[model samples]
Target: MNTVPGFRVISLPRNTTVRVHRRSATIVLTLVVLALFVLMLTVATGAYEITGNDLVATFLGGGSDMDQFIVLRQRLPRAVADLLVGAALGLSGAIFQSISRNPLGSPDVVGFATGSASGGLIVILLVGASSVASIAVGTIAGGFATALFVYLLSSGGGKVSERLILTGIAVGAMLASVNDYLITRATLDDAETAKAWQFGSLNIISWPHVIPLAVLLAVLVPLTLTMSGPMRVLEMGDDSAHALGVEVGKTRVWLLCAGVALAAAAVATSGPIGFLAMAAPQLARKVSRSPGISLLPSMAMGALLLGAGDPLAARALSPFQIPVGLVTAALGGLYLLWILTWRKG
Candidate 1:
């Protein structure tokens, strides 16, 4: 086999070959290391202040009980959840952006996140459901339903990307109104809870929140990685992908399902953390300089962004804390403006 200068190729027993991009791989590794550093910092910088030594000792099962509880029971779960949820959003963003061939094609930008939020609000405000599992189901259902609606609306025009995005924005606006109405109709306590969830906080995260999202990602991430090749192929347009023996329709459906599920899982866990999904893949692509959205790097970038944001949100105000979602939204808003102006130029 001929060698590519920037990619390393590995041969399998059955004569299969895998090519890995060196730069992308390096970027992913760097992002992962940074993510781990952020995770440790998150676990350490809190009211209790577990030093690096204490953190290592606690994880190794040698720290005092108070240190263990503060680290393990309280901070660790939130930190882990931040990483897992961020990875899910990042990967989901990559899938959507690649599929649509548009950098603005993230789940949040196209309304899936809002749809998921709508579902969760329904469960929380109308049905009075309090469990994470129930909300997760609602969010997933809502995401899939919204995807279907947008696809059907976009299919008629033969401009799926443009129509899908526009339709999603419209639908998302309507849903936002609905979400607000539901909150108004709800009791004060329920409204407050729903409002807080909408703002997206990591404060209440526990093992229960972390475990399910981690398990879901364990399945979804591998499935997404497997589909990455087909996803990249589909980027060359459906005609090319079809000529190459790819099942264009089937592949698209599966990709959309996986993307929606990832986004929904993140929303379920973190109440639709804003802009991480949209920003992570684009940032990853810029840093890696990959021709298209790279899944692993995007996932790593997402984890790093969220992991870093959480600590800032927690400590930025000292006595008062901001939601991580707000931080991402502020940053993401600036990024959006910059990208738009830069692209125009």
Candidate 2:
């Protein structure tokens, strides 16, 4: 391991290396503060308007019934959904990106989200599954199935990163087309419902959805964080990882499954919120200058982007709310361009 001045890199047993530094603490802190600000603003500024002071009063149990209903039952749930979805997307993205050692290897790009969306769409259009529980089951199943397919296809070739990425891309493209076609074949009402899937939104978030997603994130994010060491090693390439005694096969399978679960949870909660999983890790690495994608920073960036983007999407065109998915796509697209230009220069 290489270390420069003011930095210490620790190599532990089993080929785990730890890097310690505080250079980006302030930046992360600032982002966290900003996220909190955006979240409160989102909760307060809506159709059933509640100002900052009123929001605090409601939280402390003083607001009227309407305000309480709006904040507690509606706006609060949506905000929580945004945060949970962001965290899931960010963590999922970091896991896949590190595992593949490629920026394009995100759940959105890789077919997990597409697969999940397709599954949800099928349940809605074909089986008439409208209940939360059934939809969740279908969505998660689709994502897992897609991951298995990708793994199987790439396994025959030794799970090469490039090959897996290409396979996933091909699968994702096919699934996306299928999703559109399914929409076309559905009835008018079903088609309208499916349109929301095309552009992910948080307007329909309820306590039931919020609770499951929060519970899943509570379990999964911490679980994924525990593999950071192995993830770091695995990203260093196959030979180095094996030399470090990392169980190349087992670790990859676990991380890949965890990533699919995370991505599936987010998609199930908020539709295929495109570009979030792809953008969050890349943005974190850019800001922190970490050797590889840092988990906490990526989660924070994802939360900040989605949390803040919601309100901006609402207000960007007065009296007309754009979908959060569109906001993320536009924002992520600009960031992608900047990265490309910066790399070229």
Candidate 3:
């Protein structure tokens, strides 16, 4: 294994070493490089076919005004927004999976996204609160509430595992029903807007959505990363974690809070974009071949997934681009089915 600047490229026979595990590090770096290449390719793809040279010039601030405008204002921001949201969702999913010790314990699986959607709908439908902040707050409230409900339902004398997954699925179904009712009962205009929001979209991402999400990620991701030790401890089972000086309950709570916050912020910023969060972490862990969840790799994998998906969505139909969420949801649903069946057999 050769170590490069801030990264190591791992060779075949993988060993289990703690400090900067070479295999995972190398694989992650490789994925990141590939992701960047894909991102640049995507930037060049659009309604107006911009050449690689033009893309490079535009990136270097040497292209025509129109090129700059298209690249910088329209496409670039959308790409960045996708990266942020995807990374957030990926990290959240990874954290949740690690904490719950179950692959099925995702925000969508646990009803956090559905719950957040319900909250956002309440603001849009009943309270007449159309502001972004209101929606963001509602999403956070909804996600945390759903998590709390699941926790309470699954908690027994002690421990949480398979019960949590069952509880989450049930809660998720209930919240999804509530979300549907809210949408169906609203006016046509409201219903349309809610539909778009609920299905998720990166359509109207302005500075407002991008800036707040960026800031939140900057603060939360690092904080969550610092809790990795406790998270790993929790994976060893609650009693063992407690025995190992890890505050079992507190660690779970912190991870849950952080995961909910990340998911809610993403959902609020771009509605509950299906599968990016859920899929990215799983993909990252699989690709990296890590024993437990790999947070940083998951985030990178997410950014890569969305970074690629955005361009695919942009150019898939030319002038009329389908929302990024729908594209991801379709693919995600298929991938999820494959994983579930593969696991079963």
* Cα lDDT, all candidates: 0.88, 0.84, 0.82
Q: Can you rank all candidates by TM-score, best first?
A: 1, 2, 3
Question: What is the C-alpha lDDT profile of model 1 across 167-212, one tens digit per residue?
Answer: 8888888888888999999999999999999988888899998898
| Model 3, span 100-161: residue lDDT tens | 88777778888887788888888888887878899998888988888899888988866586
For model 2 the TM-score comes to 0.92
lDDT of 2 by residue, 200-286 (tens): 888688999889988888888778878888998999888899999999889999999899988888888878888888888888888
Q: Number of clashes in model 2?
A: 0
Query: Best-fitting candidate, measured by TM-score?
Result: 1
- Candidate 2 worst ten-residue window by lDDT: 18-27
The residue-level lDDT of candidate 1 at 146 comes to 88
In angstroms, how far off is 32's CA in candidate 3? Answer: 2.3
Give the TM-score (vs. native) of candidate 1: 0.96
Give the distance in Å from residue 135's predicted Cα in candidate 3 to where it truly belongs.
1.8
Error of 1 at 310 (Å): 0.8
- For each of the candidates, the C-alpha root-mean-square deviation to the true structure, in angstroms, is 1.5, 3.0, 4.8
TM per prediction? 0.96, 0.92, 0.88
lDDT of 1: 0.88
